[model samples]
Target: MQLQELTGYGAAIVAGLVIGLAGGGGSILTVPIFVYLFRIEPVMATTYSLFVVGTTSLVGSVSHILRREVDFRSTATFAVPSFVSVFIARWFLVPAIPDPLLELDGFVLAKQDAILYFFAFVMLFAARGMIRSSEPKADKSAPAEPPRYGLLALDGLAVGLLTGTSGAGGGFLIVPMLVLLAKLPMHRAVATSMLIIAVNSFVGFLGDLHRNDLNWRFLLEFTLFSTGGILIGIYLAQFVAPMPLKRGFGWFVLVVAGYIIVQEILTSRSML
Candidate 1:
């Protein structure tokens, strides 16, 4: 109804399109949208982000499933541990953190601001990976045998911690692990990452249900737009070039990350 709400919804749509087309950057932007555009507190923004990213990725994963690109065995190995890690992080670690997270002689850092700063740090890493990421060479030799279960589980744990802390799906992190560690073909890796994100995110969201009072109506509306955007992005992929889009979007992410760092610093100083 109002302009601000519309912008938030529009941001959700754009986020979904990015995920659908780029397969990794969508969830990366959700918190920034919620924090800056929707003016949500960082902790709650992360909670909302999990829902948005999870549902959007779920829709995207369905197409991969239909195309026979999902690897269920591998998905199970990776996702199970990730789910545990995220649940613990959400249900325990996040809530256990004290507000005014850090205090020094003359400085006091709020928990929400600390979380935003950490999210920005993760954003920089994701952007760098995206900009420097080379498309994987086509798998031409033989069928991809599933990689070591131990290694996949280890990666899952690490990524789950990263996702729960940052409220990001960590697809940028997941895709490479799937290919390099799990030995999945690139297509299957992308698809599997989506499912893993969906599970980690929504399950993490459940931990937030009792932690905060959420506006479900708003979340559902945002998610609906994101789903629509994913469909449009899938259709547009037929004509659009992914490389140029990804590289350009990577630069945009970098700029946004810079802004967050600077913004947090200023907010810290202003509070003094």
Candidate 2:
């Protein structure tokens, strides 16, 4: 393999490792890796991201399920509308966007540029949450209150749309909602978010199936490295403190988001 391709695969492992350790941010890294390193188109990169994040998260969810940490009732409420909305977005909304998304004055925003910009902004939001990290305190002794299904479904739809458009797993969004809205404990909330992400992302990938000619060989190969990374990360999590790692990663993501915005603007200017 070429050096760049080798490096890209290495980065895949790192992305998965981050997810394994942190339980989030896989799409933030995976989409960028595909777009910049693998030289995939931005739209297609999102499609690929759904698969990578979905499959890896599925594996993680299975483990959580085995441990009985996953809350199926909340998962259903949050994930059903989420997966449905994501499918609609991938199948109809994404394809419907015009190539040049907007034009005003002398500046033109192409579809690719728009997607990257949105993704970067989402990354910024995710980074802020990470940088100002505080674990949500849940009282394990308190009697379990029922989840607010109405709010969860609404939140699910919104997150689903975002995931479909950006190919994010939406764990950053989902975990908080689960903890606060569903009244799940922190650990259970994280586990439930994994299941929700796995379902939402896979269905989103299905929505893209009809539009894209996928290179299954490369996709599976890339995912293998990511899966391996997740295993390594899970092992390391036992020894490592996650908060410090999350803070450092938040800074890294902040830089990457900045780079993407600047690079896209520079590329657009060159094209203009």
Candidate 3:
């Protein structure tokens, strides 16, 4: 195997490890790894990302499901709309976008660049949430309010759209809405977000399967390495403090997002 391919697989394991240790945000790294290291195109990279993130998240959510931490009602409410939106984004919206989305006198913005630009902004948003102090925890002892199903559905659609378009699990967006709109406790919100991410990502991948010719062997190999890393990370979590790791990871993501923008700009300029 080429060194770059080996490194890509290694990065996949590290991506899974981060998700297992910190619980979310790590899977966003998958798209960049696929695009840069594996030399996959941006659109197909998102497809590969959906499958990897979905499978790993499905594995990660199992513990939370067994512990009875996931709110089934909230999951149903948030996930139904999310599933529909994700499918639509993957099947319709993405394909409908023009190849060269924008062009000026001497410069052009390709569809792949637009997608990566959106993904980078999403990373920036995720990084901000991670670097900041945690949001105030909801009072668990307080009586639960009736969930605003309307708002929950809306947030679900938004998150699904973002996930389908960018291939990042929308946990950063999902957890907060689950807490505020679904009235789930912080732990439950995090747990429930995993389920939502798993479902949405798989749904999005289904669209890709229908539209794209996929490399199943390579995908399975990458996902297997990632799963192994997640298991190792779960074991390591017992001894490590997640908050510090999360903050550091956030800074790393910030740097990566910046790098993507700079790299894209340089590539575009070279094209000119």
Candidate 4:
């Protein structure tokens, strides 16, 4: 591969490792890598990231299933509503939100900026989740019975809407919810989160397919590298404890969130 291609592949591997090791920050980094490194347009990069993350998550889910870590019943409960939410958000809601028109002192708020802002906000939220994850949980028992179908459906719908709108896998949000609200163990939560992400990402990707603007070459390379990284990450997970990973992930998300906020501020000022 050429130098740039090698670098891109390396970046993808890093992204996958982060996701496999932790769960959220890795996918978030994909956008910045595409925009800054690969020089892809932000809008297109988001779509591409969706495909890469979705596919990678699917691979991870398979691994989890092989290990018998996945909760299929819970996954189904979450995936179903999430799928519906994705369809509604991608097809209806996003189209309805008018792009910002007037610039504040020439700070033009492009549609892309709006998307980035949303992404940054989500990153902040994810960071908060990572911080909270470091705290000891009082309850560690899986639900005696499967979660009430209605609650799972609601969670899935909310997760799906966010995934469709932001092109995220929703693991950051889902993992915590599964642990805190659904009373699942952390490892099971991670496995179940992967399944939910895989499903939602694929469904959301379908929506993007209608636009027909994906960069297939980049997507394929990203998936290949990320898959390799995930394999390495999984192996590493066997030896390392999760606490270090959680703290490292939290810090990384904080840095990314800061960078995104700065970029938005600069974009706004440039418009002025």
TM-score of 1: 0.93
For model 3, the superposed segments whose C-alpha errors exceed 4 Å read 133-135, 139-146
Q: Where in model 2 is the C-alpha error above 4 Å? A: 139-146
How far off is residue 236 in model 2, in Å? 2.7
> Per-model C-alpha lDDT, please?
0.86, 0.87, 0.87, 0.76
Query: Candidate 1, residues 167-253: lDDT per residue as tens digits?
Result: 999888888888887787666787888889999999888888885579999889889998888777767766876667877888889
Considering every candidate listed, which one attains the maximal TM-score? Answer: 2
| Candidate 4 lDDT, 222-261, residue by residue in tens | 8989878877776777787766787678778888789988
Candidate 1 Cα lDDT to native = 0.86
CA RMSD, predictions in order: 2.0, 1.8, 2.0, 2.7
Candidate order by TM-score, decreasing, is: 2, 1, 3, 4
**For model 2, where is the 10-residue window of minimal lDDT?**
19-28
Score every model by TM-score: 0.93, 0.94, 0.92, 0.89
lDDT of 2 by residue, 1-272 (tens): 99999999999999888877777776578999999999999999999999999998888777779989899999999999998899899999999999899989988998998999999999999898888876777567988777788999999999999999999888877877888899887678877887888899899999877865898999999989988887787678679776688788889989999999999988988887
As a TM-score, model 3 comes out at 0.92
